[model samples]
Target chain A: MRRILPWLTPLVLGALFLASGQQEVIIKVMGGAQKPALAVPDFRGGGDAAQHTGVFNETLYTDLDESGLFTMVAKSMFPLAVPQRPEDFRAPLPPPPRRKDAQPQRQGPWLTDWSAPPANASHLAFGYLAVQNEQLVLFGWLFDVTQQDVSNAQLFGKRYFGPLSADGARKVAHEFASDIIVQFGGAPLTASKIYFISDRTGFKEVWSMNPDGSEQKQLTNYRSICTTPAVSADGTRLAFTTYARVNPMIFIHSLETGRRLPFYNQVASMNATPAFTPDGRQVLYASTASGYAQIYIANADGSGVRRLSNVRAIEVEPKVSPKGGEVVFVSGRSGPQQIYKMNLDGANVERLTTGEGEASNPAWHPSGEVIAFAWTRGFEPGNWNLFLMDVASRRVDQLTHGAGRNENPSWAPDGRHLAFSSNRSGSSQIWTMLADGTKLRRLTSQGRNEKPVWGK
Target chain B: MLTKKYVAALLLSFAILFAAGCKKKAPAPPPPPPPPPAEAPAPKPNPPMITLFAAEPGTIERGQSSTLKWAVEGADDITIEPGIGRVSANGSRQVFPSSTTTYTLIARGPGGEARRTATVNVTAPPPPPPPPAPKATFEERLAREVQDAFFDYDKSNIRDDARATLTRNADALKAIFRDFPDRSVSVEGHCDERGSAEYNLGLGDRRATSAKEFLVQLGVPADKLRTISYGKERPQCTESNESCWQRNRRAHFAPGQ
Candidate 1:
């Protein structure tokens, strides 16, 4: 069952829209995880760009489907007549034709065709595109077919402009989807990027891509082994480990300046697994300066370093909690590598995993209420699957089953999706899945890819 | 000839018979001289051969032992001085000596005596192994060992059994350093395929450093050692089992460039 809160006073919505200027009105589905089934018909356009039109339609559908916030109705089930504007919406759908074998016909009201039988869709997203002076102009609208009045059923009206090309159509589609998703109480995924280590260039360097695996670009060209990419929350500075100087050390690359910023060199020990604090002012990593790998935190520029762990065990993969007051890291102090949590000051150390199995690569959810990590679970050699643990209840859930090695899980900014690396498809590739282990999508197929960290 | 001449005449026969009697008397005189000089000789007994007399192991370290073996024939008594006494004609004895010493065995028989000596050279104990070289830096510790350090699955810290192996490796490195004082060893860290390629590189580095630190604590010079991590790229075994993974997760040693 789904509940729509469109009854929120216009005064409040006006205040919100006035403050953010991002959306006209919010349409939230309250109660359980039930998502409103939405039908997105093809966009009618007056351009010689059938391919661009197809690209826009497919991109829009995929963006909404992958958002995990809606149940997309297939185009095959859509009504023969599609609404390209609010005026095209018709109320009081006509009755089905009286025949032994009847089919959905264009004679019925578009809303009735969508809100009733086969489509059974509660929402409809329709749009129109036109090429004006080599520019693609898109007019998009979302409607609640449950409403009879056209004005009451219409959700919002938006326009997007891009080059009259497939890529431009895809960009416009992304923007339109972002606008619709914002109304459904979900952050726009278009702004989020995933940073990962890719060896496609003959060396493992930091590479990044859009959340939907588009617009992939190499961020680091260090012709040496680089790994454990941690992008700052603001998406400006990227911290990672590289052996560019023959020693594994922390390197802070400026995504803004496109240059490697200065980082303090500890000289003589490997520094790895650098994570930026939520505020992006400091970094947390594991270093071997104390004769053993220990968790350490330093300023963003690698100054004013302070040790956070002193145990004589292997401690690495330090990830600062999203809340900024704690850290989750992998440590061998308990004989087997286990996820451990501690205060930012290195106090109150607590092991999070219990019983048998070795766990590593702890990634905190955006809400800081749970963590995702890779664990062996006593399955024996080469089977490290991903798992999630609720920070409050200590209840653990296996996010990934045995399908080769799955590790390096990074949570999306929305806290409902994850990006990780797995060899399930052969040759360790970057993959993304919903937080519930659904909708697993492979993001990279060129060479070996691993340690995908999703950045806001 | 006198007898023949005497026979020529019967009347001269009495003279010939008197000449033959004179010749027979001369012979009788010689027999009488032999009879006066008859005497007996005394008998002699065999001497001791002293066939075998020596220590089974001629040299030994302090607190160690050797065996003394001896064999003699035709001897009534056989005695070994400097710790051993009367012994059987053929027997052996274990000897424990604090210092180098020689044992002498004398065999006495009716005819004569024979003597043989055996020495058990006890070596002095080695000076207590010097404590870890205090001057060696931490980085050098990672590069000096001649043995690979093994780790548990996904772990980089040294294991208990690996400690013993590293101890022996440290001693081997010390011996090697003595012969090639200018040579260096590279501590190459590796990992099994069980870990992410990125994390495993860090883990491999930790394993190598752990072994290096242990070797340094065992007195191997840190300056003669350098460390490198191959992560899971250089797997010693490719099989997907604990044995294979254990083979892969090791801090192997190699001659430094």
Candidate 2:
């Protein structure tokens, strides 16, 4: 069982990483059931590179901490001999046979200091940052400190180079952190983005920011009401509803080209809440073309428009399943808005939510096994909170307590996290948290923000 | 006869001599020219003359104000009607009119009395209809007589009061359909701020449908009615209270395109 245990941890981790559908990796690890305790020491080497190293160390620490897959050892508990390279990592000498009247020796800390006591870390990540040849040079290493064989303790080594600036340091740090995470059989969170609507500039425009809320940038300057931003599966395009014209219409913009794409404006008083299919070949949205709001599917370029819901009720916020054949949407056919699942051709039409209050804004996890949505369940009364429902069993779980209106849950690409908007902080703003409803971090503070959609 | 002939010849000679003498008197001076035609009596002093008498804005929307301007000359008293009793000879007055009205300016003086009329054309009535008037249009009547059906929080079922309201709406709609069979009315559902914006759209839709179905059961033509949901986007009230929320949750009617 001990032999199997050592291999089982890596196998399970690799399986989870594969199940997440992240970029394929060739590395693996052998460990136990407990979360691998990791210690990230401030990188050595400082001069003109002090500020850059500070940025790198801070960003690296945040990335690893937010991953939720590691137990970070506190800095105060770190050993004195923080390694900067493979040569710096050394094996401790055996203690003297019989220490008679011999004072305890004062020596550099060894792996025992890290593997024992308050710094009980199973793994260690340390690196060096320096300005070399007018560039920021970084060397990062991850070691399994619990390994008895000193040579086997080293897991991997990597080197990265960038411009000698804070942004460059951040880039290097993220890259190194991604490598360390991939080595541990997990998806990296540094590259994923959250798209949302913000009225900070006096107009609701499409804005995007890193999941950590850094580098918030406006993508559309329509000078009109814009909302419900959805990014394509490949993250190359964005679709949203804009009131640039007299009536609301769906507009698709190419994120790669920074230009608007052609979309046929449906002949309706309102066309809103657009979503993209997993294949990025078709777009789904709700339009009032037939005098009522119904789900409509069209080509990505807005051609071949076809209605997917035939009921004489409001069917809106149509989100296609990540597997690409089914769609879950909010409908009023049963009197109040409830989440329903249906086939691509508008058949099957199975209701997924029931009981008091309304369910809305259903978002599919990349795995397609669960959906995250907002529901005003009876217990909470008029307050809206996010919930997760298993697609097959219909088992429901509430993710957020009734604090203020918390809604618009969008699953991150890793499927373990979500980005949503909440008024818990006194005003509507974009916030992100783990899928299990922990580590809530506010993403936007300027003006009101809502309808966050995470992707890539 | 001979004596008579001699005497007649002498007389003829005298007569010829007198004719010759008359011709010689010539042009005894042409009689004095007739006196120049007499001048007509001097004109009376300038009577009440209105050089400019007008409403600065001849047309205005209901409840809007417009100014009545006038410039009068040669009159001791200048008065305007239809609200303004009297005014200076040259002055302007801002007038707030409830409906279209014509103001007449009467200038009276020693010379004469002059009158001028300026009409202010008022447009459509304000949104809130005053007590029903005889001239109200079918559209206006429908807006006035039809009461919006209200709903409870997060519920779309017809409430007791909403049932009564829908019944009256059904009757009004039936009348409208009878008069204008081609016209259609839209039932716009609205919700309060107690719900998510997206879900409220569906909740509002259900409310509108509830109202529409009730009207259909009440014998109102289902074809003449359509439904739409504004959700919480178009709230009737913004205050955060039960009264304001109740006011916001309703199935409103609008004339269809």
Candidate 3:
């Protein structure tokens, strides 16, 4: 019996270890239990090549870090020497023999050599930038270190060649980061252009910029108030509200042809907040053509406009779900402004937010799991902050802590990040952050920027 | 048979009574001369007056001008309504009324206020229908005849005050059509910046169409009026107050071909 007991104990310990290991594997496969730790080392370059290297490395790191799907390992915690080439990466070495009388030490680098896997990093992204023929070329690679077999290391690799300009540097980094995201079976943020309203040119006009806030170009020179920009699904046409004469009118500008025309120039009513359906066949917007603000669905060319919402309150800022099955909008039917959801046919009306100062600009996450909106608890000016509510559970989570008025939360196409307008820096500007409300980054610095809408 | 002392007392009482009667009969010392009749108070002047209020020529052509003259007495302030603002107590103003309009002059004084009105009649003689001019130089004249129609806050329905203005506008439009059959009028809708720009666009459209419909109902050809909505984009007044917004929320008329 004693002899059998010793054997049974070892068997029990072995089974327990195998069970825990399997559980971890299952969690990793699901990719929902905990964020995967990612290590982004500085890209290798020297001299003139280093000009874009720093920006490229930082932008890639920021892009992944703000994805909300990764926990970025700090650069300080990396090895003393980073290996930028894929061939330079090596697996951790075996631990040395320990004496019974001595205390046990850590298994890797701290105890032995520096050739070891990073601590708690399941993924590693490393790259190098070089100036080749007057162009900045980026060669990036991502590795999944979670596997025990180091021989099967390559997850994805990308090569980007562009002009040696600042915008080129950001684009290279963004493109490589998008490749890495796609490798993980996630939707890439397709909205490379963010259309916003800026008052930099003396009057509020429609302005657009790269997602990284570079190459900002004014799209309209109306010299009057222009706002509420809506980009078509194909990113070809931009529809916005402009005051060309004495009243606001919806005007569409073709990005390719550079021609502008009025979509609806009815003389007495207001039409604003236009959103194209996923199929790009129709545009849903808010209009007061019926004597009160109501949601209206119209053809792409402003024909066949019909009311979509029947409630006798101000219904504006309509956003159709990614699947085009439902819509969420801002309504004042219950007195104070609140966000509500309804079927695409305007049936099964349900209020999504209640008991607040005011809530507006409800943005549907691309995953269709959550909705983010701007909420204020009181009537105080600059009290608006962002809040995300789970569509099914109705659990509300505040995303901003009143740094300044944070309103107009727009979800990144990835469904893991958001771009919003905040006056936190004294003047309203466009800002971006992860979906979990971390890593706040300012995207605009000039002029008063508001109503940032990320294009699909 | 009475005693001698009693007879003497009775005779003395008789003599006293006879003396009192003689005094009474003598007119009681001529009583006191009658007092003079009470004098009446002098009369007070009437309150400040507007002695004269007149509009010279009284009646003129639709585009012709007239002078408004007024005289006021004992006034600290005076004003004339219908766009002739504050003025001196005794003054004259030359006014051009597109339609028959009554200008009221109000003179305020310490005693009270006196008001007088002078109406200038604008007459458009019905003429034999004229032939259409393809390249006429009446563009500016036609532009002046098309009047703006106003609306209330967040409302597209024409107000009661706007009806009179619209009637005049309709009459002028009818006359224009009778002479120039090819010209058309465009009614532009506008709104105050009190609501969302998109919603205001719809509201402005309704307002422009409402004005156009009214003109059509008043005998103007339906095809003569075209509608466009500006939706609070072009505010007549840039101020953020209600007064400015009221002016912005209107339907403006522009002569179109």
Candidate 4:
């Protein structure tokens, strides 16, 4: 086996290059409790394409590394030999069964063994890039190197064609990483955007950026305080609260036309935190139209308003479940603020959080099995931290430590990550983290960003 | 004739006697006039006297100005109630009252004290039926009548102080509804900067709703009041202290459409 190593490397590398261009290839391998180590090698391309390929490869590595589910193996530990083509190497089949009673089985060739000890990487991802007609053509492939069957070892492969630009490289990389994540039975979050409030322009306004904190752009310029932004499922409309008038009123902004229309124009009354129902046909918000802050539901256009909660206590920060069966909100009906869930019609209200301290800003996860909210211990003096509660079990897990005040937890479409605002960096800004409070990354650094809502 | 001759001598005597008696009766007519009474000593005058107190143009419309003029004799200090403090012993002040008001003037001195009152009858045109009371606009109500009810940190239940404020607010709302039957009241809930905006909104909402509910129980029509949670968005104080946060975590009342 040691003598065959030099020849085996080239053959395996060649096979990966040949397999890269194929579209929609999927393979699976047995997984374990520990994070699988992954190897991301540089793509095979030359000239201007080489630079683009480097960018793509680096981005893919970063994405996977930031996911907190994979351990990247460095290239320095790779084998000395390199294969440039598919014909340069070939794998050997396993030996036949020794017992005569054993049925004859088909055997598939496996790639060179790199899944053990020092360079123990269970999977490998590599691809090729080409510049053709001023367009970038990218080929990406993921292999389960731990698998013995070569045919089954190919996890996934995808080809992307886009403009030959840096942004194009990022797009291709993100798409490929999304494919890889999906192959691992995890939801892909790369395509989503985050909507949050920023005071960068001297006034708090609604703004949005990619999940990776790229392409940040202001969405509303009311020149006043705009906050609590909620994006529609289709990403065409944004619902937010603005103080352009005497009182804070809900407004719906059309992303396509860049026009904003007042959703609730009742003078001297507050209407805020407009969350769209799963179907986007209705909106659930906190309104003082009844002379108290209670959950109210209205048509998406702000018509046909009706009060939803009648607890006579303060009910606000309402979020409709993804399934549209119930609404979770922060209520003070039982004394200190606590998260409560009620049916769409406000029936069968049940408290979701208890014990010392206050719980608020309840956001139902898209998966509909858990809720994320902000909690602070009753006797604590610092800021609120994030917490997740299983809806069924009522078990709670703290997501953020007391690293500045972390609150306003909004779940990404994938349900595995959340975007929240924290003042840990000296000022309140938007930050993202995994569901279990890992992989904390800052998303905004400018003036007092907050109330981040992840877009679908 | 012989009898008359004989009687003449007697008559002459009788006539002489009657003339004498008539002469004596004339002197008795001047009987003594009534005697003059004895002279009495002069009495002493009282001191610290508010000799004159008057309100010029006493009959004026509501909110119209009236001048309270007063004159005091031998007084060290003079003051009036319902807002005016110590003033000159003899002075006048321009006053504006929303309704008919009676101003009392008190003058104090070594000799003693004196009191006088001048009534300014606010004489606006006859109010319409149902006794058209002075109606306060929404803004005016918010500034004048509606009280801000505050709460403890992280708590939304009405505090004792908050209850006092809500009681006054409820009374004001009742009067407002009486005068402007169609108008409604809105309670705005607010929070301090200590908590998250999302959570604060809920907290503020609870505060506002708690206040409104108290008002309802106090006879402010439930339908006449509404509630909104501004959360921490509209803070009354920006400082990072308990005082500021206490002010921020309050329910402010205002007139609504």
How far off is residue B183 in model 2, in Å? 15
lDDT of 2 at A40: 94
Per-residue lDDT for A321-418 in model 1, tens only? Answer: 87899898888787767888899999999998894677888888877778888888958745799887877766677778898789888888877788
- Per-residue lDDT tens digits for candidate 4, residues B37-119, read 88978755456988889999888888689999988998888889768989887789999977899898888887788888898
Model 3, TM vs. native:
0.60
Candidate 3 — which residues are off by over 4 angstroms? Answer: A1-33, A46-48, A90-118, A131-135, A163-168, A261-268, A379-382, B1-257
Task: State each model's TM-score restricted to chain B.
Answer: 0.44, 0.48, 0.46, 0.47
Colliding pairs, model 2 = none
Residue-level lDDT of model 3, residues B83-163, one tens digit each, is: 988998788889999999999998888768888899999999568688877654456656677667889865677888789
Global lDDT of each model?
0.81, 0.83, 0.76, 0.78
DockQ of each: 0.19, 0.17, 0.12, 0.23
User: Model 1, residue B34: what's the lDDT?
Assistant: 44
Compared with the true structure, what per-residue lDDT tens digits does model 3 show for residues A1-456?
A: 998999999899988976664333212222465666777878876556687777777778777766667778777667765666666655554555664555444333221122244456777887788888888888887877665554566687778887787778888888888888777766666346788999898899988887667778988899988877877767788888766664455788888787984465433346677888877778888776665668888888888887788976667888888778888888767865678888888888889887567677788776676788888765452267888887776767777887987887887666667789888898889998876677788989888898888875
Whole-model lDDT, model 3: 0.76
Residue A28, model 1, lDDT: 14
Per-residue lDDT for B3 in model 4?
91
Among these predictions, the greatest TM-score belongs to 1
User: How does chain B of model 3 score on TM-score?
Assistant: 0.46
Off by over 4 Å in 4: A1-36, A68-71, A74-77, A82-110, A147-152, A156-158, A261-268, A378-382, B1-151, B154-189, B202-229, B236-240, B250-257
Candidate 4 per-residue lDDT, tens place, A1-456, comes to 999999999999988965662211101111233777887776766556777776787788778876656777878876544333322225653446676655434222224545755678888776678887778877777888787656677777778877788888888888888888777676677878899999999988989898889889998888988988888878888998887774678889987788976565444356777889989999999876665578888888888888888756666788888888889988778876778998999898998888457777788787677788888864364368888777876767776778888888888876767899888998889999877677889988877899898986
Error of 3 at A324 (Å): 1.5
